[model samples]
Target: MPAEKKAYPLRISPAVLEAMQRWADDDLRSVNAQIEYVLREALRKSGRLKPGQAAPVADDQDDST
Candidate 1:
C-alpha cells in the first residue's frame, strides 16, 4: 500500500516559493513532495538519517531549543 501523506505548514518568501514550484515541475513532483524530498536529502547528507530510516519530524517546539 502507499504511505499516507502528511501536511506541514511552513512560511517562505515568495521568491523561494516560486523557485520551489519550478523545481517541482522539473522533477515531476508536487511542491509539497519536492520539499519533503529536499529535507530528506539534507538530513541524509548531514548524517542525521540512517539507511532506510524515515525523515525526522520538524516540531514547532524544536525552534525554541
Candidate 2:
C-alpha cells in the first residue's frame, strides 16, 4: 500500500516550470512525480529525511536517475 499524499497549491515561474517539465521528461516521470522525486532527493541529501526511512523504490525500475 502507498502512503497518502497531501495536496498543496504551489506557485512557480513559467521558466522554472518549463525547465522542470523538460527534466521530468528526461527522467521518464510525470511533472508532479519528478517534483516529488527531486524534493525527496534534496531532503535526503540534506538529512531532512529520517535515518533508515528512505524514498520508496520502484520495484521494476532502475534508480540510476
- Candidates' RMSD to native: 8.5, 5.6
Q: By summed lDDT, which 10 consecutive residues of candidate 1 come out lowest?
A: 56-65
What is the C-alpha local distance difference test score of candidate 2?
Answer: 0.71
**Steric collisions counted per model:** 0, 0
Task: Let me know the TM-score candidate 2 reaches against the reference structure.
Answer: 0.76
Candidate 1: segments with Cα more than 4 A from true spot: 55-65
TM-score of each model, paired residue for residue: 0.73, 0.76
What global local distance difference test value does model 1 have?
0.69
Please give, for residues 1-65, the per-residue lDDT of candidate 1 as tens digits: 34445556699999998999899789767777677779888889999977788743433222221
